[model samples]
Target chain A: MTRLITILIATTLLAACSTQPTEPDTTLYNRLGGQAGITTIVDNLLFEIGGNETLIGFFADTDIDRFREKLIEQLCEVSDGPCEYTGDSMAQVHADMDIDNRHFDALVTDLITAMTEAGVPTGAQNDLLARLVPMHDEVIHAEEHLNGDER
Target chain B: MPDRKTRLVTLMLTGLLAGPAFGASKILATSGAGSIEGAAGGGLVPWAVIGGYGSDGEWGAAASLGRVDVDDFRLGTASVLAGVHDRLEVSFAQQTLQVEPLDAVIEQHVYGVKTRVAGHLIYGRLPQLSFGLQHKVNQNPAIATDVLGANSASGTDTYIAASKLYLHALFERDLLLNGTLRYTDANQTGLLGFGNSGGEDPQLVGEASVGLFLNPNWAIGAEYRQKPDRLDAVDEDAWRDVFVAWFPNKRVSVVGAYADLGSIALWDDQQGWYLSVQITN
Candidate 1:
């Protein structure tokens, strides 16, 4: 009886260590207060960054309104909110333009400004930046490839 | 003598070879701080301004070593800086500008100081405004002693500067704008100018640059600078530059720039290639 008890205890301990993480609820719509809330922030960001003269040239041939909607949709989808992401990989899309460090910095500043305008708290901004941090490697490497430059 | 010259050249070459590639990841002005360029003593166009992301802290610092072939001189400096809770920054820098004219290995030394005040314009929805003041101790006993002019320390020469930085995004694009204005005190040193009655005047120097973000970590940009002749008799020309900067992450970056430094004594126009490496924590 004692041996059996010991065996059960061991199994319990093993299970505790190996337990899988609960999957995040993919329906982020409710958590984010639905699409309306997300849309407001996205719209604000687009408007501010779009009117920036230094950054405006990058979108000379692009559509600001459509891009804003897409960004909102993707952000909403990624945060376990109820949504879908249909955009291209971050690298593939930015491969053609010769994006560099300065450009990246400006984008971060714009995003921060947009978030502030949309009332996203600092903690939330940090969380969002953490999630998107991985994309930096891809985007930069893609541009370097275009120029045949390597480090 | 030939061997010594060769060794010096080799040392300089090695320095260039090992220097950072993305410029300094720090600011160059005395008020902004955190740049290797400060060690060189004074700001040099294209060199000082062509930097990666530096506006992070309430303040940053930098140092550099500089040389002017025409004057046959070299200078070194150390600087300090602080940012105002990330909304604004105020900086102060002191430097030792030394010259090594042809025959003299250590010709003369001059002391310099610079101050910068920058703030993010939150009042009425305007962008951030960057301002600066740079001064030098003009009582150059070396220059004065050389010309038998005076025997005491001199007054504080000044330079006033301003700039506006903005970030933008449109559709799949990202952009940045940087505008600058500078007014120098004819008596003070502008960048590397060390002597009295010499160097560029206290006129307005302006800069405008635009960068397009290809992605979150990459970008391309173009820039231009306007210079005024400090001397009443000489005509000084302005310059322009273009560059490509690569950022692998926020912590590291490399930049390659083409610069035109107008004309120097024998070099006609001082145009060359520059590579900068920037590192951040």
Candidate 2:
């Protein structure tokens, strides 16, 4: 009876663990189609955002080529690729930009559109978006001015 | 002539149409259509996602109508939900179950509240987690007690759900996964009533959904919901469904599914179609 109970408990524990979703062994960078794919996606995303009137104002004074390179590097580093991002920290880059949730969401939309057009798998696109989502706190600074006097 | 329910639904539809179109802030398809219980989720399972496009300090509301027709039974539900600050959601739902041949009608009033406890579905390493409670009351206690052998006319279900959107899981598609643990004594989702004459305890059950986004607006998924077997009169089996959902725009969504409800009220193999339409602001 004791031996039978031990087997039953082991089987139940294994079944429970098997029900949970497991992460894949492959890194996100490789899943995102590597360097060339990332470049194409970033280019397409920037192009789409550049054409949008609502977003073009944010990039008007920025250097297109340098910005593109920095974005590619940032994405590569974030995805665990063989590249280093030399760009400024997210907080430092957007400190005084007055970026809000609206602009951040718009950029994310453009990025998703670009990834979709470039045939980046939906899973990879979402994975990348998940990593970038936490940056919203560092990037959005509209409330700072609203409570300026209090601080 | 349209009945009072029809007129009320029409008025709500008109209001939804006239509501201002807010800019879509949340990711498309992130705020899923209202579930049968009036919470933001899939057809039957309530996901951890908060409803609407509302984020912090914002408010949003949604209305939905759903119909599930099986071999022996038919269920119709209408619900409205409001979300505050993307953290708390409160909702109301009315369900009507129609039994064929016997032509018995069971009605239920459900009031639900869910709060996002932690994490972000798309942005964080931790999966989105939420706590939800649904208080359900059967309109006719005599019918419930006599036909279903229920001990009470009302019950409350409490659930904890965790949801995660896995970017690029299969063939480059985004996958949305959710798991829920619920404690309840409700029979037939509370349409029949709570507990039974068997002196059964409130059972803990599991529900899960796995969805693959074909695009930003479309998703295909499957769900499994475990149920309790309390009444000795008839056996209740688990419920499962394969579904497709379409988001035509930010304000409107439609879902169609094939569901297997198993034995319901002595009828077996209760499998058929499920359809729902939702409008949000």
Candidate 3:
């Protein structure tokens, strides 16, 4: 058992060393197929979201065109593409949605589906997801912060 | 007396009836495979996550069947588990060990309960932690008590397990790490009954597993389980396995592995194949 643990530890350390961040400009955006690729990914995401019952209601009142533009911009900005995000903050935009963990997970599933449909490689998909995962609290608890402001 | 099979079928029937009302909420593949002791985990160790797809407010249930074929013996376990509000889990497993030499079988029942104490698997820095207990009853302990001079036909194992998922940790695949510390006196996991020549006191043992999700539907991993040497009749050795698990959807999953059960009773180098399937609501 000790031997097994030692091997696991060694493997983890090796993986950590190998994962030292790659040069930004070359990997993520290129893996995501740059802006054209990002657009395709966003279109596929929209299509996927269109078919999801749990997430459709949230977008019912949204402006599809603007939402598309902002989402593409956000993805591009996060991927460090030569684009600027002109959309509202994640918390500000999602403040009134009453979103929950289940909802967020559903969206994540749809996003994964969208990315998979867009033929994004697993590594790139994971890289992009890592960038976006930190926003979970802001997205789901946006309403709580809004209420806190009121109180 | 209602045999273990009858009890298992009854529980499965009840779960099937009640499952659809409030199940399948969590993301796919989060509810790891079921262990022989009926906890959600790798085949050999219980993980910290509760069984099934229930998230925070939902309920979920699952049933599993597992088998292991070794050089000298064959082992089978059938289990059912329920997850309540994604916090507490209660489970039952019926294990049978077929001793080819003795041309006999030893059957046992394990009732387990685990509660998530703190943290989350994928959310934040803290690994998911849980506390659990498995109360095991050796239905037929003639060989254990009369022949091997075991102390008891029943025992309880308590453990604290922690698990975490590192997203994109290696090769951009998700990696899962689980560790458990258990206090137990059972010999061969109670197939040979509890405590013997080694001592009456339970010993602390360590168990661990590491898995990498190849995708949302498939994962490959390994497990190591330390054992206590309490029986004078034979020396107990640790267990290990290399496994591949497939979670096709929320309803079903399959796990297959190559296992090395070091030694059991008088047998040596008891290496073989292991397979298990779990159906989750």
Candidate 4:
């Protein structure tokens, strides 16, 4: 029994060890091709979103050029790139959009399609998606959270 | 390690996966495989994920056929599942079990309802949690009640399942962990009927599964199910399976596994292959 327990512990430690990043040269931003690559990805995302009727409505009143710039900055900041996001907070920007999980799913689908079209590898795509997943709560329940803050 | 026969099977599976399109918004394989009991989960254990591709405010359904063949037994099942608003799931399955020695066939029907009570499969602080109940009835109960001295021909099993996904956790691949706590006394999952002949109480058991995503389209996993030891006439061992699943599109998924049922009734070393295909919309 003791030996079994020891083997189990060793396997767990090995699993934990593999999660650590081993590559010093390749940051997530570098894998996405840095500035030029990021621009292409964002552009591809905007094009796909434009064609998606369900998600396109959310951007109806927004200024396209500024939205593009802010999104690029946001992606860069999230990927640990060399840019700082100067736009409004995620919750604040999406506060009145009335977005729900369905819309969120559609948007995520479009983003993945865009990244795939931009030639991002599967590993890099997964890494970026994982980092952005935390913002889901902010995107969907922005009004409720903002109301809570006000209260 | 791609052999010619395996490559042929893979190509055939790829061909079978191409069908008409139906849309569901969730990411690929976020909804787990169709369990034997008709719930969304691994091949043997139920998971917290709701079946189908629907997100909030959306509804979807799935239909599946599964078969398992061991040295001495054969089991076949057909199941259908419905998911409402990404929160509630209702399912039904009919299973047939064939025992080689006795040349006896037992048919059973299962009805299940599962609801996700908290958290999300992805993007949440808490692991995805769900509560579910499965009611089973044996169509051919004469052998169990008359021969095995079982408590009843019908029984209900309740469970709480939790699941979580860790991104880039193992070898730069995503890892999924799930645990299910179940309450039941059904012997051989109700194939031999419910409870022991001497009226032993239902026991709490554990079921768990782990999966590593090789890519967005493919995953490899293993599952273990702990069983009750109530039947004095027969010894029932635990169940285990290692599986590979392919999601060619939102419409279809295929799962193949090597299952070890341990021992069933009088037969020992009950190991076999299991395969299932599901279509969703």
TM-score to native of every candidate shown: 0.44, 0.79, 0.88, 0.89
Candidate 3 iRMSD in angstroms: 4.0
> Residue A60 in model 1: shift from native, Å?
43
Tell me, by DockQ, which candidate is best. Answer: 4
Candidate 2 lDDT, A29-142, residue by residue in tens: 887789988999899998889876546898879899999999999999999999999997776677677775557756887898899888876567767876877777767753
Q: Output the lDDT of residue A2, model 2.
A: 37
Cα error, candidate 2, residue A119 (Å): 7.1
Tens digits of lDDT, candidate 3, B24-141: 6577788889788889999999999999887776788888888999899998888998998779999999888899987889999999999999987877678999999999999999
> Per-residue lDDT for B107 in model 2?
80
Worst window of 10 by summed lDDT in candidate 4 chain A? A1-10
State the TM-score, rounded to 2 decimals, of chain A in model 3: 0.81
Best by lDDT: 3
| TM-score computed on alpha carbons, candidate 4 | 0.89
Q: Write the per-residue lDDT of candidate 2 for residues B1-281, one digit (tens) a residue.
A: 23466467657867977987454566677778878888999999999988876665567778888999988888888888888767899988888888886788878888999999998776657989999999998887666688768888889999999999877565456789999999999887877678999754699999999887766788777788999988767778888887879997778899998888888877888888899998888
Write the residue-wise lDDT of candidate 4 on B169-211 in tens digits.
7777788999999999799899989987677469999999998
lDDT of 2: 0.80
List DockQ for all candidates. 0.02, 0.21, 0.34, 0.42
- lDDT scores in order: 0.43, 0.80, 0.85, 0.83
